[model samples]
Target: MTSPQSVYRAVAREVNRASISAPATRSKTIVKNFRTIIESGGQSNTEHFDHDLANAVTFMKSQRMYKILLERYNPLHDMSAEEKVKATARRVGLDVPLRENSDEGQ
Candidate 1:
């Protein structure tokens, strides 16, 4: 069996290997700018509010795209067919029925 330390190291390595794209970097910058605006109570003009609103929308769209990509490329997709079915059933608050004997269905 793999040790817990090895598993954690592998996860850390994968996380480090995933480099941030330009758009993600921009999103972080936008979030930081918005946070600063909010902290400084600087919503003094309609144009400023509009610009901030646009930034917020852009950030939300990027967040949604990232979520879709993550779901599509999830490692859980590597599960066997039977395991997938069991996972789906469990997700919906149901359980796959257990068989008493492997040859019973035959």
Candidate 2:
């Protein structure tokens, strides 16, 4: 009993609703996976739809993956590589020469 235009409109509305809810669902899943990984000592019994969340976390943290994720997922993510080295050195009480002169004439 609906016109073609009305069917198209309905489909569009449903698509918009799904799009709105999709991100929230994905965010919830990510948080849940992180929680499971933490609670289970690096084990996850649940099957992840796209990727294995626990394994992905392990790979990212391990040398298998690059260090970019640390900046991607933290407040200090904005710190540059040089800044991170400096911060690490300071934290461990190691003296590091300034970047400008540390590698100069060597």
lDDT of 1 at 85: 89
List runs of model 1 lying over 4 Å from the truth: 1-44, 75-106
Clashes of 1: 0
The alpha-carbon lDDT assigned to residue 14 of candidate 2 equals 34
Worst 10 residues of 1 by lDDT: 10-19
TM-scores of the candidates in the order shown? 0.31, 0.25
Among these predictions, the greatest TM-score belongs to 1
RMSD values, in order shown:
16.4, 16.2
lDDT of 1 by residue, 1-106 (tens): 3333343344333333343665445334444544555445433664565455555555555666776687797846768999998988998999999868878767
